[model samples]
Target: MVNTFQQHQHAALPRANHDERARQEFTKSLKQFVQQGLLPGLTPVYQTRAAKAFEKEHGKPPADRWDIRKAMVKDLYFQHYAATNRIAQELLWEAVIGSVERQLPELEKAIADLTASNPAPLESDPAFPVPRYVSALDIHCMPGGYASEIDGKDIAQGAIYDRGVYLYAMGYMGPDNDDMGRSVCNYVKRKMPGFQPKRILDMGCTVGHSTVPFKEQFPDAEVIGIDVGGPCVRYAHARSKALGHDVSFMQRSAEDTGFEAGSFDLVVSHILLHETSGQAMPRIFRECHRLLKPGGLMIHADLPPFDLMDPFTQFILDNETYYNNEPFWGAMRDKDQIGMARDAGFPAETIRFDTAPMAIMEFAGADTTYTEDAAEALAEREFTAGEYAPGGGWEVLIAQKAA
Candidate 1:
């Protein structure tokens, strides 16, 4: 997380405020929103209605799809409400991230410090685990995105995160993750002419954000989500149990999940690749390959490759991939994932990368299906890369497994 000029806008030379009135008002509003507009009172009802409507259309729920209808309301309300208050979200992040953000300067200084300190590498120590990649440097802008279990309990650490986002994710950040969840779930439910998945697995399912969607999509499939974080697994279990979603969450590194080969009909991940090291990416793809049923599918939702990004948007969004605790993002875009998919044994033609239209066929008051005029089809085709608009970035690469 450099404060340096060119890189972070400060990376140019290396350098870099807000006011109190706007700050206090923003904080007050946030507190009010949390206290009054969010959580217990509001989210439950919203998610219930959303869930009931889906259940009405789909019939019964999967084992893990328990009371998720309730969780959905809280999740959605927070996302929509926060997006409307972008300025407030920025203020809040400045406040919440201040402590972690302060340590950024140390990263550059550490490079100098490590050199000056003369860390000895013994000739005999050929196997010493020196940091191998540029990714080890920033760690996705996270304080320690790459560290292996600083504490004995990696899940606890992740749960702390789950709690934080669960409580505070105000706008797009919340929805970017959850909107993908709802979109995927709703999409899986409607069926595109004729398609079906027998079993589904979600990778990097932090607190089940992406995993929950599959329940709505293929209600009959056995859905499982795996991640390295223990807190996320434990909490995901607890939350899913409460919500009545029968899905399973497990604490396992995505790299080597010990599941049966060809056991899953679909393996899914949302926004996980950018946060992982390039070296780790292939292993994850292979794991998905090992876990999928023959002709099963693997699809992921994440930021598009650099090929699709404009310079200005690229600089802005990519800057976060660097400074915002997601240092691996740039590397992920740089890597040719098609090769990885192929290495994992999928036919080149089988790997379908499409940015499915984000919206579902309909909402209650609207028409049952959304019509796509010629222009609309083109835009929908670009749904993965075009929706970021003037403010945010784009989405690309649905990346399905071969038939």
Candidate 2:
């Protein structure tokens, strides 16, 4: 099938001119080709040649992903596959950066105006110290990390991310790139039918792509999205306003958000844990527990543990740690998250891992690309390492405090 995917336009998103649009489209197509056409070859290449070669060089065949990695890295096919994947990622960000930079002044003004008119709170602290994990390197090779601001009020990083994610995901995340949050919300609604939260907190909500869905799901709830990146939260506020959601956005770290104890009925994060360090992960769980009220829910939607997948799949997913700027990508999966939740004060019986079925089918008629057949196929497809979100659903770590 010709990839008919296209990102739906929004006011806060950056506009791309003809040439820029072509470049962005090319990057997206290249990524699709990498995932659909090229990604599968690694398995055959590894099984047939790479593994045999390793056996010849050493005594035994590869025993684990580490051993498999040692074998595959030397093969020409793996080299080409890895290089093309990295190039696609680098191009994906570059394609969006120019559009954002050119429209910086206009984008900033528009965001400022949108945020000013929105009744919800938008808070930022210039004195807040950005964690070294974020500042260490430009994550995902995006030139400036999420926190970078121009004149202490930049929105370029957020705009770039907003546009870039569509290309990066090949439009699999729906028009707004909010599939993860939407999936989790659907899970909550389906699993606990009567659980309507009064206050919702989204931790590490960069640009609020995943945050706005909660407010949409629970209109009566007070939804708030917090992030350490000032630009991210600023853009999130404007984006939420532009999307017609009254959600608060604040510059705050997930490790120790200064919210009062038991202030929120629901505290969640989407793909945020993998980005944080080993030390930060446990603390974030504790913070989530602290922020949540008695009988409240805490959910983190992220990649499943390394132990769940085969060695080869783990090897494929580990490529993010080496190629992409995701420092904790591989390591985070190794951490015992259920145990961490227990340590964070959640009872052992209350914590478990669950699959939140992808809400893609709900978007069937929302966009041309999201046809019923296509959405169903995406939702039912098997999980492949290195693809965007899992085919079946988002893996969510869920816990509820004792009433």
Instruction: Please report the candidate that would top TM-score against the real structure.
Output: 2
lDDT of 1 at 359: 38
> For model 2, how does the per-residue alpha-carbon lDDT over 269-314 read when each residue is reduced to its tens digit?
9999999899999999999888889999999999999999999999
Q: How well does candidate 2 match the true structure in TM-score terms?
A: 0.93
The lDDT values for all models are 0.50, 0.87
Model 2 clashing residue pairs (backbone)? none
**Candidate 1 lDDT for residue 140:** 30
List candidate 1 stretches off by more than 4 Å: 1-159, 166-169, 173-177, 189-193, 359-403
Q: Give the lowest summed-lDDT range of ten residues in model 1.
A: 1-10
The predictions' CA RMSDs to the true structure, in order, are 19.9, 4.5
Backbone clash count for every predicted candidate, in the order shown: 31, 0
Q: What number of backbone clashes does candidate 1 have, counting pairs of residues 3 or more apart or in separate chains?
A: 31
